[model samples]
Target: MQNNISHKQSNQAPLYLTNFISFPYQSSQQDIPVTQFMALSPFSVKWSSNGTGYKLYANSNPNPIYTGTGTSFDIPQGFKHNTTLMLEASNAAGKLYAFLTIIISKPTLTPDSITVAGTMDNPSILTVQGTLYAKSTLTINGTLNLGNNNSFNDITVGATSNIRGKATLAQLTANAIAGGASITTDANCALTLQPNATVNKLDTTSVTASGSSNIADLTVNGNITANKASITMMGSWNLIKQGSAFGEMTITAGTDGLVLVYIDPDNCDAGTNATAVITYNGQQYSVNGVNLYQVQSNNALKQGYCCVPVQKGTSWQCSGSTSGNGQSPTIYVYWIPFGADKSS
Candidate 1:
């Protein structure tokens, strides 16, 4: 875009444009933005030492893709989202030239923002650079330097969103978490696993606790007992889990009380609360207030008790003692039914 002339130039020597000006090349679909090229005609005539030079091409496929003579150049670092740049301005007897074309956006487009700031390195080793759908609420409180040492992707926490603080990765790809993040508090979350980091498609308000902890109530079936075993949530437990062809653990039943055994997912094997009514596969569930049930054949207090619609080869055995009083807290339904009876 140039159209300012002055007349007479018999062989170039008595002219003036010490530096006609132009330094524009900047864009961002939603990141890496800041293109400075707004000040031109600042008293011209320096045209890069006059020997003539100014080249910058993009996706133009000419062997010279992304070259710069130096008015300004920095819009080249993995650009992809609207790349269409072409600028050529010449001199040195080429007789004065100019041709501009720019299209690389994002200065301030407000619409549930995704234009994150730059300068990252502190436990941050990103990959899976695509597919992000956050209608709202997605923030991290700094520190992400995880340089070289990859294996991290599949971060889906949509449907009542949340992603707050401390993110370390080497493996955490469960790829399916959206039950309204339970009650969110991710309690000072921290990560440092690399054995392919193993499954984490979570939404039970993922809080890794550093001070005031609480990451309970959402394990009725999320599957991540990878056995490299490392579960820490600090006391107040309600670690709900369900998926039993067999194998489970929460031990130490003689110190104060904590013995819930049902070993079998083959041999590594893997609920609670009042009101009782049980039956799986044939469908019918309700467990309210004072309940405990293990099975081999015995569940005579049936009725659609409350809200137990969890099924899949059967799993729900909450251990005894609902704070004793008149005694009816003994529940043992360890599974073995079908043409059997225990003296009913």
Candidate 2:
């Protein structure tokens, strides 16, 4: 008896085989981590193939390091560096080839530049040999030790924040405070508070206020000295109680027989003239002229009080005079001192 024999043969080569990689595939772009990639003694690998047999070659090896009739294979690991691998497969139809680079160690780097696009939580300390710049706000919740000088355009400190370290700056600028704030410095510390600033206890070298300054109370522990310190006042005093017009009104001499007006020597402005005028009845009278009789009893000294005696209901009044019949008229006063250094 004769039997008919038949055999099947492949006429087309393998096509579209991809993702030829080992398990836990380590990408070329990322550092090959230690426990997952480098520690495997024999890293397992698998590939897609429509071929009969395959052979894997390592770094310039003339002989195949691994051979398999199936699609999966193993790479005898124990590699200490980046390794190059080549995969060759062949079948009755044709042959196919692929290449791979395995990473067995992390790359060494000086890391001159690194941009952290996402949050980086590193438990270890990072040393930056070059400058580290942040396009936005760089918040540091941990301690940062700066190896070199750094410059910042603006910095805001919270009300609870405090600067306690010693620093010597060539130039330092601080903004004004709108609300109440306090600044305290040591005895040797030198602090300067510029315009529009407020503090509770200021032991500073200098405090200048070109703008408005409101201090509830200021207590200076050191010596208080003034240079060209001055207080100026300009206005007139209204002496009369009732009047039919708006000119100088004078008060009739009272029965006290005492000088009705006296200027405190310390509060007087010496060099300038403080001319007196009397608005009496309905007309204006100058003290240097008609109202001079009020001080005639004391010879009308340029300073001090003058007495004038007259009966009530008389129209003898001094217009814009500080003294009245029995009342002291309201007047504005200012103090300004001029000279060398004066201490208090």
Candidate 3:
């Protein structure tokens, strides 16, 4: 009798484990960052293994998060911490392992637009990169930083809210703004105030108003010094007489108490004893005592000038004798209305 020999086949460990078929085992570990504002949807990690069974462990724990023969493991939602996941695939021989790192990071929000129905309270600093729009009101207890080249529209700050730091805005409409050291505009830019806008107090070193400025009421408590002053008269340089004898020239006054008279006598002898009288409001005023007369020996002419008081809308005239003999005199009169004094 002959003895028979027995034969046995040995099992082999899993090989070539990979999530991607094209690139098998390209990397042993994978890092994934989870943000605060990120979606909490279920995710899966798929792999192709030659093993008959698979188990996924989290953070080196003894208990497995998932155990199945499927090629993919579904990660549950609401995982909000840093976790290290290990996928172990096994057969009759040995086991193969794959690692993944879930890194929990700080919240980063990059939204195109945001609408808050109620209130958003942040104790720390709040920085904004893009355009922010508040339909109702925006209240910030801490600092608010609006980065460069960013603009916002229609922001209403409450009384309790405090806004600090540099802010560049396209347009701002507020009922009142208080407690700022200074507010400045860019070059070639203008800060426009509304028609009904009222500045209770403005304490600045200097103020320049360009173009046409229509101020309803401006009161200056301090002294006003200017280079030049221009006064516009209602009627200027009216010729009462060109070459005429001494006679009364009637004039209708345009403004009260603002009148100027000019007299040019042909010869100095004509103005030696010259005397002019203004009859206004049933009263006679003399201009002979006025020391505004100039006598030129070269031209033998005398020029007299005076500013007299006259009632508005009243009939007035200047009548006087300029010469003892026959001579002609040139006379002119003008008046300035109220609120015609302007300075440039």
In model 3, how large is the Cα lDDT of residue 304? Answer: 71
Count residue pairs with overlapping backbones in model 3. 0
- Lowest-lDDT window of 10 residues in candidate 1? 261-270
lDDT assessment of candidate 1: 0.32
Model 1: residues with Cα > 4 Å off, grouped in runs: 1-9, 12-54, 57-79, 83-86, 89-91, 100-254, 257-344
The TM-score values for the models, in the order shown, are 0.20, 0.24, 0.29
Clashes per model (N, Cα, C within 3 A): 45, 12, 0
Over 4 Å off in model 2, which ranges?
A: 1-171, 178-181, 229-344
By TM-score: ranked, best first: 3, 2, 1
Q: List the residue pairs that clash in candidate 3.
A: none
lDDT of 2 by residue, 99-194 (tens): 677666543335567777888776656666776665655445455454445533323332332333433332234444433445444455454445
Candidate 1 per-residue C-alpha lDDT over 75-97 given as tens digits, one digit per residue, 9 for 90 to 100: 42434233334434445444333
